[model samples]
Target chain A: MGKVKIKKKETRIDMTAMSDVTVLLLTFFMLTSTFLQKEPVTVITPPSVSEEKVPDSNLLSILVSPEGKVFLEVLGSKDSTMKSETVRADLLKNMVAEYKKTHPSANLAFTNKEMETFSKLNAFGVPITKMKEWLNLEPDLRDKFLESEQNPGIPINMNEDPNNPNEFQMWVRAAYNSMNPELQESMVKGRGIAIKADQTTPYSVVNVVMDNLQTMKMNKFTLMTALKTSED
Target chain B: MAIKSKSRQKKFDTRIDFTPMVDMNMLLITFFMLCTTMIKSQTLQIALPTNEKVEKEQQNKVKQSEAVTIIIDGKIDEKTGLSNPEDGMLYYYEGMPETDRLAQGESNMEQVEFGDKDGLYPAIRGILMKKNEEVVKRIADLKKEWKEMKFSKDEEKNDSIYQEKAKAIRNDSTLKRPVVIIKATPNASYAHVVSVLDEMQINNISRYQIDRINDVDSAMMIMVKAKNEKK
Candidate 1:
């Protein structure tokens, strides 16, 4: 009789097929899916009805701390590729210069307009002087102008057109002109600004932000919020 | 003869192995999916109405592009036990004519008044849900109606192929969105404050401009007539 021998066969799971399937699905979703981004900071928002979705490109953000300090955060701007930080640095310098002219002995004691003007920040995207107007800083701008001995034009609450006056528009135009050609190609089509504010803040601070945006002639915007609450 | 000998010895396997390439593609896709942001459709668009130099008339007629308002009047106190146990009236301007009326429930609306029997006190036109189970119930009811509305034209197209039994109770002048105007008394609580906004969402009303920012002098207050009313 012939002797019989038993041998074991391998039973390992061939991950190759599974891996291939996973890769196919990943590629499909990658090609078809859109990516949404939140602003770097969080903002508490007041309730409103309009549900306009702002696009991501060519957008800017201006931060308003609860203590009323304004931080300009520009992104995908019409001007310089590196606009916000540059613009912010320039604004602070200009504001300091303007402040020093009048309040020689005093630190910048900027007088803010009423609390309502701040809420407009999400609507308009402009520069510092226009931001001041939206914040309803009639007294501060007026005081600064009076101190510098320059004639103040009528305090126009032109919240719609922040970039209209030549002064605010010129800097923005320069920022756009200075961007690197290759980088500009990536961001040229974008058109929304995102405004992120804390909930406890009065509408006045927000208004100031929007007013500045309008003066800068930046119209489109996105207001950041936490995900909408779902029913249990 | 040498070339033939080489070919005869072995056949070369020319199928380039695709396994590793497929694995790398899957990893790349996973990374992009995690980073992608799905954008939401546009819902709210409000243009800040250019402020007119404060004119003399209390009933100042302002013109706007697609303007809306919220007039809150919550002075009724029937204290309807079925829902919303909050104090005073958190009234919503329902844009209905016959005063706050229910088509079926025990109607105590006529008995509600603001302070000294004038039929006003913060009534039930309010906002979002409250652990105020009643507030949530009302809001849900309102949301149900809004969700039923086919906002897009595609839904309307789908709806065209329907029977009379499938019709919704749409009135010709019923407000799809009521411009809420708050007329609350000075003593109204913060609940009233919340309900004004709540009612706006409940009714799917998006455009809202506070008549007066914060100061409530007679000059600051506004009145908006509800739709389908005989007042």
Candidate 2:
């Protein structure tokens, strides 16, 4: 029998097609993706059957951590960047005024650049007194400050009086007043306030937040939850 | 002509390696996957009445027969030293529990578990449905009609119809609907309260309020937990 000889073929086949497909996918994801905003604390929202998607804009998100610390995020209407900036600027001004009424000697004033930086932040929860210091920190240091155990959340006492409300209530009112009239109407119609709490957060903590809103006459709000899979 | 062709025929390899490019693409894809959130979160809308003093006239607005109170309380397990989610019991009662029974040192409070193997416990659903059968039936009928018309395709119309139906159910005086008062103990997790509220939404309950647990109610829960521990 003749010795069998097998032809040795080159192992290098074309990977150009694969690269092209992956590049296309990368582009698609990069263009359409919105990066997840870095939160001070991670929370797993409880699963629910409700299908109402959280509104993309004109939303005030109240994030409650498992440890009962509360953080807030305000996303203005998507159509106009100027409107949101204005809202943020006005919110800062109102917050300063409210802070001044409580502490006359404290300087709560911020420069325009500082106000712009604060307006651009995705989430904030530091006390008004420390807000200036928090914002002025280097980006890396700011993250460290937010993540540290020393950062107690904005003071939220049980004060129900509108005139002498808690800091949480003051922020909510400031956001409400600063937003465009249209957004305020939408909020009153139940599309504005969104509470995102950890699944393990105790009921008493949530109760306090709700009671604060109740005192402010913010009766309508939406609870943010993950979609419940059928198997669960 | 043959000599000229031979001289011109100098071949060069045109293949370029794409392994590095593919490697870069994989890295990019991984980055995108890590940074992007694929699922947009769902939202459960809730409306709570303003925190105002209940007037004497307004106190009688909810009929005794159409009232159900659900209390959620958490229990810590001794064996594992952890708060057992299963230990979170839901105590529900129709109308107010009799104080006389409490004075006699007997507890008449009824207890219901959360969801069972299949889903929401049928017994709880039965009680809720029986209490608000008329309104529930109306909501079912409207939902069926909406489905038959394929109104979901028209978002605005569907939303308006849903709003109208919810409003009508809220205002309907002829058909009595159960008014659920949800009370959670301090130890209970917010998830438990949200789950119970989700049930209210699922059962088409229009009138429900989250209230603070009172002293008598707290006493009843403690008694119930003690009884369960023995078992």
Q: What is the TM-score of each candidate against the true structure?
A: 0.42, 0.87
Return the lDDT, model 1, position A70.
44
DockQ of 2: 0.62
- Candidate 1: stretches off by over 4 Å: A1-7, A32-40, A44-52, A57-194, A210-232, B1-30, B39-43, B54-156, B159-201, B204-207, B211-231
Best by TM-score: 2
What are the lDDT figures for the candidates, one per model?
Answer: 0.39, 0.79
> What TM-score does chain A of each model score against the native chain A?
0.38, 0.90
Give one digit per residue, the lDDT tens place, for model 1 in B1-231: 999998798868555566676668777776887777554432222233334233213224422212233333333333421111133432232222222333222121122222222212233322212212333444455445445754334665434523221222212123232333444343343233333444444443443443433332222222221211334
Deviating ranges (above 4 Å) for candidate 2: A1-10, A83-86, A229-232, B1-8, B55-59, B76-86, B116-123, B137-172, B226-231
Name the top DockQ candidate: 2
Candidate 1 residue-wise lDDT, A35-95, digit = tens: 5533323444433333445544444444544333443333434455544434334333444
